[model samples]
Target: MSSPGPRSSVSPSGRSWRDRRLDRDGSLGLRLTLAAVAAFLVLVPFALLAVLVVGSWTPLHELDAAVTAALHRFAADHPGWVRVMKAWTHVFSPGPLRVAALAVVVWVWRRGSRRLALWVVTTMAVGGALGALLKLLVGRDRPELLDPVARAAGFSFPSGHALNATLAAGVLLLVFLPFARGRPGGRLLLWTVAVLLVGVTGLSRVALGVHWASDVLGGWLLGGAVVAATAAAFRTWREQAGLPAGRTTVDGVAPELVDPHA
Candidate 1:
């Protein structure tokens, strides 16, 4: 019998095209990619609002007014839910966030990743400052068609709670994702919680009748910008310090499993 034909080599770890691309590029590349997307989200939405939506846009303004008024009235009509929402909303406010920030910083430091801890703190600080500055520039009035159910003082173009919550949650998740590398469904769960936190916090402002819907949307976009920039910076700094760039492998997948070439 003729000898068996040569058998093709199998990777032993069934990798895919995406895996190979990620492995070749690694962590810094991934961060930079995300940063590009985030920058687009940040600039585009804000510019659209500043140039088109804020003025010379009667229909959009009407929509914002309708939604804001509806939510405010709905919450007021439901006394029980209003109370719960108010309490839940505070968790994202400055008072509660101060404690949460302290806890996260301490935990990261104790875990021996001072760079990550510092990244969290600084990202939040800078994002908050930017939010404040943007609010000043927009100088949009709060929705006063309904009585405000919560105390607030500021120009309302962008909701500070929404912006701050997005930044804080995004930074925390990105920084700690490496730890979830091997845990099943860990990244999904983290993302779910983060998105929920951001969504609810933004809605809470509308629920209280203190912010228009557009304000929350702007905050969300702005927060995305901050998260992307800080994440990119964090990884970049590691490379500068001579630390090996983290592999692009996520959720503990071995490079070979995802990289077809491997």
Candidate 2:
């Protein structure tokens, strides 16, 4: 008797994710459980990254050394280029992030998406606290380059600039994805831009000779974890508000629990 190779896969139970969603019912308990699992899955890589980079890992150390050396070499001939990277680096600096977040908060609040505005601020606040905790735990030092083009203070296990940039980019993506519904091209373009921004921001640290390659990697991973958690939280809020699962536009946002504008 011939057996069926496999049953046809069901459409993602809900929407989004690997283009296929898991079969999760609409229940607060289920959402919380799912959120926790998703957060843990995202955070595991960050934890592993910290362990690998903080320890005496030869391969990571070698790669870090090679990248730092190459960037240092490039800086020697292209001083102007290094200066550009240094300037670009400020886009993700603490001051810019704070300013951007404030603007976003105000914009979203005016648009009647107070929940989203709150999430935006919370993500940054949580990132700063988590970053400090990770740095204290890892206790790693900044890169000692032959010729550093920039100076930094504090432990350098994870690049704060990279982390904050990633969070900000992720927030923008999440906020705008609803606008991109039914337009795969726009979604793809946004994803590409987000990736490039995150990559360049992380690389800026190494290029300017302030952070090791491994530190940037750790920041990316950690930032990814935080983004995942925040996205899940926002999704839950949307679902509870009776918004559409797959497509939700700014015009569709329900009044938040605490409406400052009201």
Candidate 3:
């Protein structure tokens, strides 16, 4: 009789050897678990904040009032500071962030990573749209400060500036982090800049007396949830395509971008 055929290497589930290795390593499971946990943590607070804002919770309202009043007073006294914040907010506003993301999308698309480019566009578009819808649904008003140093129009539970800043920061960090792979300092600097941009942009919205602290906080939480959710989805797609499950915190969302021939 003919020799038995070589033993099949494929798993019972039809996964290849590489996929079986990935399953044994548990990297994909860990990544998805972390992303789910992150999303849950952020969304819970955001939901609480929304509920409180809608219910007009006394303590939260009082805190918002106090913070807004304090910031307004400071803005009223410091003309230079107000001017700087205005410039900073404008530079990081939704319009500019969209333009920057568009540039990145174009670059990546040209580089043949159409899916990565599409991911960027979808994340930004969905985040912005959802934020706008939440504002309308919440029907929360912007902080009405006496002698306001800056003005913003529309419902303001989530500060548009803060949300857009956060979306932009996450998008840019994930897109560019691949280039900083081997350089620890470069990675640190990238993370530092992203954090500062998100933090200060939110703070500026409050300091300008256009958004309450809670509004900025809500923006941040929602924006973070969107990024985490999208990153998790992208990682799953990569795994299905037989690509490495690169960690977003280290290897970024698209490690293949670092390959010149890719």
Candidate 4:
């Protein structure tokens, strides 16, 4: 009798590892849900592109109307708002923003998966290149603005800096989600900081006269699509490779060593 000796009291060394595949009953539903969302994100961009293509015939005339309205309003009142808008240009300044982003990534690298770091670099680099190619094809001219703060050399239909910012922010989020395991509060804080930095960079481009509002918007759409596609690819790769999805790393130290999500 002896109270059955606390059946299987010891947990297995790899007990934290969980299977990522859906169970039989849930598989169909999960697959369908993912497919629907994937199709939506993919198709939305093409629809937006269609609008831009049709609008190109009168882009300059449209731009003139918009800029004139804005200037007339600014001339009447709210000079401070104009200055504030101009100040936003600082966000797109290449040097300081780049350093700040890199600092966040380095700070997050406690147990540091080199693969994750590589993915971040690849996402940004490929997104930037593709954006540049598209800009060349569109060959859109920059907006005409008086006393612009900085000069941008690239064709201006879609801002490359804005595109890169969105991709870098989004890919980092996906790469970090699987690794996050500590108090929910800390995870939320980190994500908020990352998002704000990306948003500010994109906004800065418009304020500085380096890109139009539409250019920044297009960059966000294109960059976000690339990021989502990359994340989906990574999910498939991890599944095929049979790596642990949400488990703390066991190859080096015990789960308790690095505070789970740090």
TM-score of each: 0.75, 0.81, 0.86, 0.63
Compute the lDDT of residue 64 as modeled in candidate 2: 86
**Better model by TM-score: candidate 1 vs candidate 2:** 2
**lDDT winner:** 3
Span of ten consecutive residues with least summed lDDT in model 2: 249-258
Q: lDDT by residue for model 2 over 165-239, one digit each (tens)?
A: 888777767666655556788878777887888899898898898899888888888888887787677767677
lDDT (10s digit) by residue, model 3, range 146-186: 58898889998888888888899999999999999999999
lDDT of 4 at 89: 47
**Colliding pairs, model 2:** 12-21
List runs of model 1 lying over 4 Å from the truth. 1-42, 53-56, 240-262
- RMSD, each candidate, Å? 10.3, 8.8, 5.2, 10.8
Where does candidate 3 stray beyond 4 Å? Answer: 1-38, 260-262
Report the C-alpha displacement of residue 257, candidate 2, in angstroms. 16
Off by over 4 Å in 4: 1-40, 50-112, 146-150, 177-182, 246-262
Please state the error at residue 160 of candidate 3 in Å.
Answer: 1.0
> Ten residues in a row with the worst lDDT in model 1?
251-260
TM-score: which is higher, 1 or 3? 3
What would you estimate as the lDDT of candidate 3?
A: 0.88
